[model samples]
Target: MSIAVITGASSGMGEEFARRLIAEKDGFPGAPFDEIWLIARSEEKLTSLSEELDPKRCRVVPLDLTSADGIARLSSLLSEKAPQVGLLINSAGMGKAGAFASQSLKDVESTVTLNCTALSEVTHVVLPYMTSYGDTLPKKNGPRIINIASSAGFLPQPDFALYAATKSFVITLSRALNQEVKPHNVTVTCVCPGPCDTNFIKVSKNDPNATFTGFKAKFVTTVDKLIPASLRAAKKGRSMLVFGFGQKMLHLASKILPTNLILFFERNMK
Candidate 1:
């Protein structure tokens, strides 16, 4: 079956994407990409989601995108299944909660592995099938790519420095790739969401001083709000979507103000 592959599918936006696609079978408005291949590192959870979502159209592939073997295994899976990967969502990433100087080398490495290495590796391996002329994929009506970036991408977070860097990497990479594929009718939209309930805060927060304000204004955002907005931007092929009024304002501010000033507040605000 034709498909849209999404990483980090165990929970949060990843899981929501699967459910939303299944719930709305017609695909996102102007951009329609049917089927979804869910990827995550948990077998039990993937299996459960697959069953619960009525896998009539969804396929759960428990994948750890951070390893070479994982990529090899997925490449093999794609070869056999050869589902037309119409959409690729690089939603899998991790963050560390410490100043750059305080975080352990291993913590830094792991964060980079998931947030940068794995996502890029998946895109690297999968792009051939999705963009290549191979029998390995079913015919793609139109292909689209969406990377789950963060409003953190717009500025550097000194406390969460590494994580902020990774998000910036995602935002830049998505824009660069979008330029390459526009000629072939493919769309790439980077979603810079402020915050919603997600395990990221739990895993990334280790200190009492760790603060999340501007981007993750706890008072306003909810996953219920983010998912729909992202889908709408993806449908219209928006190059970048800074969700939430706060994030939109931040994006606009970045244009008029020096980045250093914008970053000053991002790293120091309440």
Candidate 2:
């Protein structure tokens, strides 16, 4: 059986991907799959989402990838199913917005665990189940992995230091893994988007009223725009996708400008 495995599938970009894949509403050609696996910590949310979509086609797997047990459970499920995973979107992540030292030990560790460690673990577990190029599956239907990174990863941020660093790890890992998997006909696309109007902000800042403003606010995007574009990029087998024009420029600036200069500007941007 062919399946699409989406982590963080209960909400935000992950939820959007599941909806688009099921509805096929986005202009991008949707991949055919016998099942779409919705994975997240909230079983209730996942079940609700599965019912909202076609439950028969959606399998809800509630998993807290930050913990070892969660990863083990996922691995066991994949082994038992042994399905040909046609698509894997690792959208599970967390971030804490504050000075590095001000953050609690738990928060700091959780961010790293979810955003970096879990992502890497989940990807490796799923790779074995992904369809290979020579598996008689049509090339157009070849397996694809979309990893949700951040434009913040292009450079360091003063207040959001750890989040940016972890995302940098994501960008580097995805790029290198793409090269390794290219020969197998499995493409890995890293999506680096700027700020978005999602639950992410509230959760990161630990405040419902928290949001981007002034210069930073201009770059905020919606999943409605980001997810579809990312899917298209994945279909085309692009290695990296910087979602917005502004974010693209930012990505370029990180490459051309000196790091100290960029950090200076970022520090004074407020």
Candidate 3:
């Protein structure tokens, strides 16, 4: 069976991606996804989403990817079934906004594990199962991978130091992995979306009053706007996608702006 595996599918962009895939299957010609493996930490939310989707096509795997056992479980399943991976969305991540010095060791470690380690492990395990190889160069086809990196990945953010650094790793991995998998006809896209109207703020434990301030406030993207744009960019086999015109301009700025100058401005903003 062919399948699309999405992490962080309980809420936010991951959940929206699942919904859009089912709704837009006809939009993608030759889409062969007969099943969707929804992986998330929340069993309740996963159960609810499964009920909403086609029961026969949706399989909920409620496991915390940060845990070694959870990662092993998914790896075993993939090895056993060896399903054709049509798409893989590495959207599972966590962050907390605060001074790095003041953060708990647990919180810092969790952020690094979930945002970077787990994502890398999942992608590595799934690559062998993707049905992207062919006799000819595959154009606009899967298996495809989308890693949900943050706009913060582009620059240093003082209050969000750990999160920003982890996302940077994600962006780098996505770009490099794209080249590595290209010969196999696989496409990897890194999505850099700004703040969105999602529960991420709460999940990240951002201070309510200071959550979206300064330039970040102006470029807050909605799930409705962000997911489709990301999906479209990935389908086109783009290496990186920064959502919204404002965010796009920001990405460009990161490339042109001097490192010290950008750091100075971000430090003042925080």
Candidate 4:
């Protein structure tokens, strides 16, 4: 089965990835693993996209991946749908921005649940099926796993401490997993994107720091740029896909500068 399973497919990079696969045809065409699964908390939105994506080839399962029951249901679906899963995109994530001391406990908890726990659990369910399972299975490409991290994770977080820390964990874990899974014919890629124009802003609305007060939103690219880049990274066998020049600079700075100087910028970013 050439099945490519995507989570957080309702919007942003996940949605773009789905469209790219569908349009590219070879990767996700109208047949085979061409089947697309849209997972999110909103069924209405997912259903609409599924229909647009072609009902015969697309399926939607409403899920709140933050919950254990939701994760189990998704796991069950995976077992029933593609017993030999091909690609997994872990794009389900939310953002929070604020003074850590002033943020709500709920925000912190939910971020960990969806961004950290859900991503990891989905990886666990998808990995085994992605491997070469005793030959009788139809021949196809091995599984590719993409974790949506953020450029924010490259350095110490300021107001949005937990969100950055969680992303950092994803980047770290994905790289290590990539090394281990290489021998198993599996690829793990961590995509660290800088400031994209998505629900990220609305999600972080409660936090004053998210306003990006003086910055131009136009500088941020649409989710479309990320999908192709992500796939290219996967094809090249790279473990890291850090997007945008600003992000690259920050990542570089974090490495070259003294800890105190980098920490200063992180803490003082207004």
Candidate 5:
């Protein structure tokens, strides 16, 4: 059976991606997944989204990817079902907003565990199923992977240290894996979206001492724009997709500027 697995499917981009997949009449452009497994920590939210899906077709896997038990559950499902993975979206991510030293050790560790470790594990587990599609490419409808990174991955964020670094790891992993799987006709696309107006921003604001308020409120994008653009980019087999013209410019600048200078500019931007 052809299926799609999406993490963080309860909210934000993951939720939006679920909505898009459900609405697809002829499957995702290049990749067509008939069944979708929604993965998230919030069972209630995942259930709510499931209501919008065909009960027989969609299965909600409510498990925190950050935990070993949660990852084990997903692995078990993969082993038992052994479904052809048409699409895998690793959108599960978390971040703490403060100086590394000021944050609790647990908080710092959680960011890395969820953002980097869990994402990597899930990808490792799912790749075999996806690659089982045989040696021949299925035209544009081959296996695809979309990993949600962040614009912070492009440059070093001073206060958001752990989170940014984790995203950087995601970017690197996605790019390298894309190359490794290219011959198998499986494409991995990493989406690096700038500050999007999602639950994430509200959560970040709740961090009292956090200095994340650089962009104007109006500039913040909705998930509507980011999700589709990312899917389209992935269908085209692009290695990386960064939304927003300003963000594109910033990503370009990060490549040319000195590390110290970029950090200095980011520190004073707000």
Candidate 6:
């Protein structure tokens, strides 16, 4: 059976993707997935989400990718089922906003663990399943991997140091991995979206009211808009997707301008 595995499926962009994929299954390049595996730590939320969709088609595998035990459970399930993985979306990530020195070791470790290590581990496990089918399926419709990175990855932020650095790792990894898997007809699309109105901000800042500031706030995109655009870009085999005009510009500027110049402006803007 062919399946689409989505991490962080309980909320945010991940939840949006799950709903849309089921709602418009035929529209996606790789249509007719037999099952959609929803991976997250919240069993309650995952169960509720599954009930809302086609329960028969939606399999809720509540596993915290950040934990080794959780990842082991996923790996074992994959081995047991041996289903063909048509798509994989790594959307489980977190960030704490503060000075690097001031942040607790736990928060810093969790950010790096979820954003970088877990993502890489999940991808490594699912990649074999995807690559195995690449030769038979057309490149356009072959297995796809979407990594939900952030616009913050483009530059280093003073207050959000660890988060930005980890996202940068995602961007770099996804790009190179895309090239490595291209020969196998598997495409990896890294999505770098600006701040969105989601639980992510509340968690990041540890305050409900905290959110983007200045121009960053102006370009914030919704999950409703971001997910569809990202899926479309991935289907088209694009290596990177920046959702908003502001974010697209930031991505370009990061490439053209020197790092010190960008950092100078970033420091002054705050």
Best by lDDT: 6
Task: Write model 4 residue lDDT over 1-270, tens digit each, in one string.
Answer: 456778888887888877776655444211246576778888887888878877776678799999879989988887776556557789989877667878788888899989989998988887777765313333224467889999878877777778889999999999999887776667788999887877777677754355344332534766878778888887566789988887888889988999688877655654
Write model 6 residue lDDT over 1-270, tens digit each, in one string: 888999999999899999988865654434678899999999999999999998999999988777779889999999999988888999999999778999999898899999999999999989898999776786567788999999999998888889999999999999999999988889999999998878898888789888777757887778989998998998888999988988888999999999999999988887
Best by TM-score: 6
- For candidate 2, the per-residue lDDT at 191 reads 97
Instruction: Score residue 45 of candidate 5 by CA lDDT.
Output: 95
Local lDDT at 63 for model 4? 92
Our model 3 lands, by Cα RMSD against the true structure, at 2.1
TM-score of each: 0.87, 0.95, 0.93, 0.90, 0.93, 0.96
Model 2 scores worst on lDDT over the 10 consecutive residues at: 23-32
Worst 10 residues of 6 by lDDT: 23-32
Q: What are the per-residue Cα lDDT tens digits for candidate 2 across 1-270?
A: 778899999889999999988865322223457789999999999999999999999999999898879999999998898878878999988889889999999999999999999999999999877744225555545688999999989999888999999999999999999988766678899999999988898899899888887788988899999998998898888999999999999999999999999988887887
What C-alpha lDDT, on a 0 to 100 scale, does residue 103 get in candidate 2?
98
lDDT of 1 by residue, 98-124 (tens): 679998998888888888888788888
Ranking by lDDT: 6, 2, 3, 5, 4, 1
Q: Quick one: RMSD of model 6?
A: 1.3
By TM-score, how accurate is candidate 2? 0.95
Error of 6 at 154 (Å): 1.1
For model 5, how does the per-residue alpha-carbon lDDT over 84-202 read when each residue is reduced to its tens digit?
88789999888877788988888877888999999999999888988876244466567889999998898888778888899999999999998898878788999999888667755
The total number of steric clashes, by the backbone 3 Å criterion, in model 2 comes to 0
lDDT of each: 0.76, 0.88, 0.83, 0.76, 0.83, 0.89
Once superposed on the true structure, which residue ranges of model 1 sit more than 4 Å away at CA?
28-35, 132-141, 206-215, 218-220, 266-270
Error of 2 at 34 (Å): 1.1
